[model samples]
Target: MITNPSTSQLVRSVSTELRAKVLPELTDPALLVEVEMMLSMLDMAAVRADHEIAWMMQEADGIDTALSEAAVEGELPAPVRDALHALQLSRPADLTYPEVQRHYGLASEALARAADQAHAGDERLRSLAWSLLEGRVDHELATIGAYVAVGRSENQT
Candidate 1:
C-alpha cells in the first residue's frame, strides 16, 4: 500500500515490458482469452483488496469499543486479543482511509500488468485482456492478484 521502491520498480518493469515488447508481439486472436482472464483476475484482486480495506477500516474504528468491552466483560479469545493488541500497536495513520486508497492504487497497477502481459501473440489472450480492460468482462470474475513481494523492502519497525 505504501508503494515502496521495489513495488514501484516491479510495476515500472511490467509496464515497460507491456508497452515495449508485449503489445507489439500481440497479433493472434487467441491471446484475447488470456487478456480476459487476466482482467478478471485483476478486477477480482482490486475488489477483494477494496473489500478488505473497508473491512479493516471498519474493524479499526470498533477496536476501542471492543477492547474496552473485552476488558470489562472478561478475557477475549486468543485471536480477538491478538487482533486488539495488533490494532493498538498499529499507528492511526496506518489504518487510515488514505492508506487503503494507496493499496487500491497498487491493485490497479497490478491488474494493468496482468492485462498487458496477457498479450502472448494469441488472439484469445488479446481479446480477453481487451474486453476486460474495455469493461466487457463479466461482473462475476476473478481477481487481479497483488504482488506482496514489496514486503521485503518494508520497514516493519
Candidate 2:
C-alpha cells in the first residue's frame, strides 16, 4: 500500500550503500559475499512478510478492494495476479540461517546476512510500509549487523 516511488528508490539506494560500505570493513571476502547473499535473502523475507500481511488483509476483506475490486471479484483480477507475483518473488528459500549454514557450511555467513538484511529493511520499512508490516525487517537487520561486527572484529585482532 505504501507505494511512493521516490521513497522506495531511496530505501534501495541506502541499503546498497550500507552493504557495500560494510563489506570492505570485514577483511574476509567470503564473509562479505555471504553477508550480501544473506541480506538478499532477508530482503526476500521482508517482501514475504509484506505479502503475507497483504494476503491477510485480503482474506479479512474477502477482496483487496484497494488493488482492484474487479480483480478480486472477477475470475482473474489484475491486482490478485500482481499480488501473487509479488508474493512469489518475495518468498525466501525455506532455509533458516542455521539450516542455510549447515547445508552450505556458512552458518555465520547466514546469520550475518539475515541480520544485515533485516537491519537494512528496518531502515527502510518506516518509509516503505505505512502500517504494521513496517517493522518486520528491523530485527533481522540488527541481528545481522551485530554478528558481522563481532566476527569481523574477532578476526581483526
Candidate 3:
C-alpha cells in the first residue's frame, strides 16, 4: 500500500526545496526578497494546513454558541436579536466557508453589542460574553503560536 504526503508535509518539502535549491540561484535582489516573503507565507500555511478547517469550525461553533446564549438573555438590541435569529436559522454544517465566516462576523458584532449592554447592567451576562471572547482569543493564539514556534526554530538553526 502507498501513502500520500499530507498537506503539511508537501508544503514543507516544497518550501525546503525552494530555500535550498532555488533561493540561492536568484540573481535579482527584488526577486530574492519576494521569494523570501513567499517562503514565509508558505511556512505559515504549512503550519496551518493540518488545523485550518478544524479551527474554522471551532470558531463558527463558538460564535453560534455565543449568539444563542445572548439570544436567550433577551436584553440584546432589536437589530442584534434579528441578526442572531438569522444566523441561528442557518446551520453551520450546511454552510460554506464564506457563509460560515459571514455568520461568525455577524455573531461577533452582536456579541460585542450584547457585551457592552451587559457591562453596563448585567454581571452574569457580562461574564459570559467575556468568556466567549476569551475563548475566541485563545483559539486564535493557538494558531499564531504554531507560526511563532516555526519562526523560533528557524532562527535558532
Per-model TM against the reference: 0.32, 0.26, 0.64
Mind giving the per-residue lDDT tens digits that candidate 2 earns over 17-56? 6677876686676776677666555544544443443433
Can you rank all candidates by TM-score, best first? 3, 1, 2
The segments of candidate 3 whose C-alpha lies over 4 angstroms from its true place after superposition are: 23-34, 92-96, 115-126, 146-157
What local lDDT score does residue 148 receive in model 2, on the 0 to 100 scale?
Answer: 40
TM-score, model 3 to reference? 0.64
Assess candidate 1 and give its TM-score to the true structure: 0.32
Candidate 2 C-alpha error for residue 3, in Å: 13
How would you encode candidate 1's per-residue C-alpha lDDT over 65-146 as one tens digit per residue?
4344544666543444554455455544565667755543433433344344455443433443464344313222323344
Identify the superior model by lDDT, candidate 1 or candidate 3.
3
Which candidate model has the greater lDDT, 1 or 2? 1
Which run of 10 residues does model 2 get worst, by summed lDDT?
A: 125-134
Give candidate 1's whole-model lDDT. 0.45
Instruction: Compute the lDDT of residue 152 as modeled in candidate 2.
Output: 49
Model 1 alpha-carbon miss at residue 60, Å? 3.0
Per-residue error for 12 in candidate 2, Å, reads 5.4
Positional deviation of residue 89's Cα in model 3 after best superposition, in angstroms: 0.7
